[model samples]
Target: MAGLFISFEGIDGSGKSTQAKQLARALEQAGHEVVLTREPGGSQGAEEIRSLVLEGDPDRWSAETELLLFTAARRDHLERLIHPALAADKIVICDRFADSTRIYQGTRSGDLRNMVDQLHDLVIGREPDLTFLIDMDPDTGLSRAKGRGGTEERFEDFGADLQHKMRAGFLELAQQFSDRIRVIDGTRDIDTVAADVLRIAREAVGVAKSDA
Candidate 1:
C-alpha cells in the first residue's frame, strides 16, 4: 500500500486516543490526508456491535463470544473504513487494533492468545506499518479511565490487577514486534506525549513513502 497505517495501543486511559487525534491534526497540517478511527466502532455496523460488546453485564458474553463480536466489528471496520482509506493512499491512524484483542481477551480468557493470532491472520491479515503502545502505570490508567465515566465500562471494570496484566502483555507484544511497534511513556504531559508521537509517526510516514 502507498499509505501509512498506524495503530495506537495501550490499556485504557493511556492517552492513546489523544495522541492519535493530535497526530492526525499534525499530519493534516503537513499536507497529508489522514483517517483517524477506532476499533470496535469505526464503521456503522461495527459501532452498533460495539454497544453490544461493551455494555451490559461483564459476563453478558463469554470470552469466546466476546472475541467473536470483536472480530466481526473489526472485519466491518476494515472493509468499510480502514481498507478503503489505505487504498486511497490516506494515512490511517487507528486508536486501537488487533493488539487490544490479543491483550484484552488473552488476559481475561487465559490461553487464548494463539486463537487471537490465528483469527487475526485468517480475517484481517494486515498489520499496521507502525504501532504506538502508550506505556503507563496501571493505577494512573485506571484512575484516568474511571474519570472518563462512560457506559463502556465493561473493560474498565476489570480493575487494577487486570490492567497490570494488560500492561505486561502490551509490553511483551511491543518487544515481539519491536521493528514495527514503538513504546512511548504515556505518563508525561499531554503535549510532551504528543510531541513524541508526532516524531515517531513522521518517521513512519516518511518510511512508508520511501517504501512506496
Candidate 2:
C-alpha cells in the first residue's frame, strides 16, 4: 500500500507501452525502486495464458471465456509480481490492467459492467495509484498498428467498430475517474507524450512518498 502502482492504458499503437518503459527508466534514474510489468502476461503461468488469450482461436472463445482468461492471468500476475513488488515498496508500472477488461470485454460483450465490477471486487482489491489513459483516434491507431507490419493478435484483429467502442469506453472511464486517471493525447510526438506521462507520474510519486 505504501508503494505506487501505475498502469498505462490505450488502444493499439497509442504508445502507452513505450511511455511506461520510459517512465520506469526515469524513476530508476531518480533513485527509486521500480518494477515494470504487464497484464495478461507478467508471471510464467500468466504468460502462457496470455498466449491463449491473444493467439488462440477466436471463434472458440466466447466473451465470458475471454474475460475469465484475462482475469485468471491477472490474478496470477498480482500474486506473483504485483503484490510482492508493492510490498517491497517498489514503483510498479504495468502496461495494462483491469480497466482493459472493462473497456475491451465489458464494452464489446455488452451488459458486462456487473461482471467487471464483481471481478474488481474479488480480484483487484487495490486500484492503481495512477492510470494514464493515452487517448487517440481508433482509425489513426489502427493505421499505425498495421503499418508496423507485425502479426495481428486477437484484439488487434477485432473489427474497426469494436475498436471504436473500446476507445470510447476508455475515454468514459477516464472521465469517471478523473481524480485517479489522466487522459493524455497519445497522437502527440513521442517525446512530448513521454514528458506528459512523466509529469503525471512524478506528481503521483511525490504524493505517495509523502503519504508513506
Candidate 3:
C-alpha cells in the first residue's frame, strides 16, 4: 500500500509501451526500484493468454469470452507479479490495466458496463495511484501501428468506428476520474511525450514519498 502503482494507457500505436519503458529506465537510473510490467501478459501464463487474446482469430472469441479471458490473465498477473512488486515497495509501471478492458471490451461490446465494473472489482481490487492516458486520434494510431511491420491483432484490426468509440471511452473515463488520470496529447514528439509523463510520474512519486 505504501508503494506506487502507475499505469500507462492509450490506443494501439500511441507509444505508451515505449514511454513506459523509458520511464522505468529513467526511474531506475535515478536509483528507484522499478517493476516494468504489462497487462494480459506480465507473467508467463498471462503472456500465453496475451498471445491468444491478441493473435488469435476473432471468430474464436465472443465479447464475453474476451472479457473473461482478460480478467483471468489479469488475476494471475496481479497475484503473481504486480502485487508482490508493489508490496516490496517497488514502483510498478504497467503498460495497461483494467481501463483498457472497460474501453475496448465494454464499449465495443455494448451494454456491458455492469459486467466490466464487476470484473474490475473482482480482478483489480486496488486502483492505481496514477494513470497516464496518452490520447491520440485512432487513425493516426492505426497508421503508426501498421508501420511497425507486424501482423495486426484482432483489436488492431478493428475499424475506425470501433477505434473512435474506444478512444471516446478512454476520454470519458479520464474526465470522470480527472484527479487520478492525466491525459497527455500523444501526437507530439516521442521525447516530449516521454518528458511530460516523466514529470507527472516524478511529481506523484514525490508526493507519495513525502506522505510515506
Question: Across residues 1-212, which tens digit of lDDT does each residue of candidate 2 receive?
Answer: 66999999999878888999999999999999999999889999999898787774546577888889988898899999999999899999999999998888787766787898798789777689899998989988877776776443667677577778889889999998888889999888988999999988999999998899
lDDT of 1 by residue, 84-121 (tens): 99999999999999999999886687678888889989
Best-performing candidate as measured by TM-score? 1
**Alpha carbon RMSD to native, model 1:** 0.9
Worst 10 residues of 1 by lDDT: 104-113
Ranking by TM-score: 1, 3, 2
lDDT of each: 0.91, 0.87, 0.87
Poorly placed runs, candidate 1 (over 4 Å): none
CA lDDT for candidate 1: 0.91
Over 4 Å off in model 3, which ranges?
Answer: none
Off by over 4 Å in 2: none
